[model samples]
Target: MSFVRTLRQATAADHEMVDAHYGGFALDRQADYRSFLTAHARALPAVERALAEASDLPPWRSRTALLAADLHALDAPIPAPLPFQPGAAAERWGALYVIEGSRLGGQLLARSVPAGLPSAYLAAHHLPGEWRRLLTTLDTHAAGQGQAWQDAALAGARACFALYARAAAIA
Candidate 1:
């Protein structure tokens, strides 16, 4: 299987758990919207920073600022980011997978945001073919690496999901 498929399979439970947690927040309400953005604010920055530090991946536009702006528009306090540091190249790829994948869901979630609410974060999406490019990059990277690397990537994705879940619980 391609690395993207492998990673998705490995993280299926984690992804569902995150979705359930975030789904509890009804984005139609301003208060729930604030909490939702707050939850994301608590996790996204650290992950983005870690990915940036990894540095070998393709250029990524950080959504941290967009997330922060959404919160600021609501007059909501931006929570401190949860700590996340991906230690290996494969691990970083895993973390990036979770982060980037969320954008796909965000496009759908943006509709839940009621009229007049800031949705720049949810509206921010990868460019056309960007996701395919990312998948290709992951598969290429995994092609030469052994099972240990794949395992690390799985672990990294799980860790990232855990961070988001934690943030949701707190929010």
Candidate 2:
């Protein structure tokens, strides 16, 4: 099976759990949205940093800055001390998959945000076809490796989901 397919299958439950945690467009209050962005801001930078160590992968563009700006715009207190640690490059790619893919959902969530709420983090700097491009890169890179590589990637993705779950709770 393709790396993307395999990874998706392997991480299906983790993906569902994270998606459930977001709870769609139900965040009617600014406080709720603040928590969402805070959780992402807490975890994304660390994943991006880990991905940065991999020369084969494209440079990671962090949305934490935009998330912070959105929090500030909404007068939400920035969550303190995002203490996430990253794994090796292959593992980090799995984590990056989750982080970068969030933008796809962010676009959907942005549309559901009630007017008067800040959504800069959700709507930040989107480019057409970017997700597909990144997926292709990841798929191509992973396809060349052995099962160990794919397993590491799967583990990384699962770990990221759990991390996000905890952050969401605290946020």
Highest-TM-score candidate: 1
Tens-digit per-residue lDDT, 19-72, candidate 1: 999999999999999999999999999999888888677666789999999999
Candidate 1: segments with Cα more than 4 A from true spot = none
lDDT (CA) per prediction: 0.91, 0.76
lDDT score for candidate 2 against the true structure = 0.76
lDDT tens string, model 2, 70-96? 888877777664555555567888888
Q: Name every residue pair that clashes in candidate 1.
A: none
- The number of the candidate with the highest lDDT is 1
Q: TM-score of the candidate numbered 2?
A: 0.89
Candidates in order, TM-scores: namely 0.97, 0.89
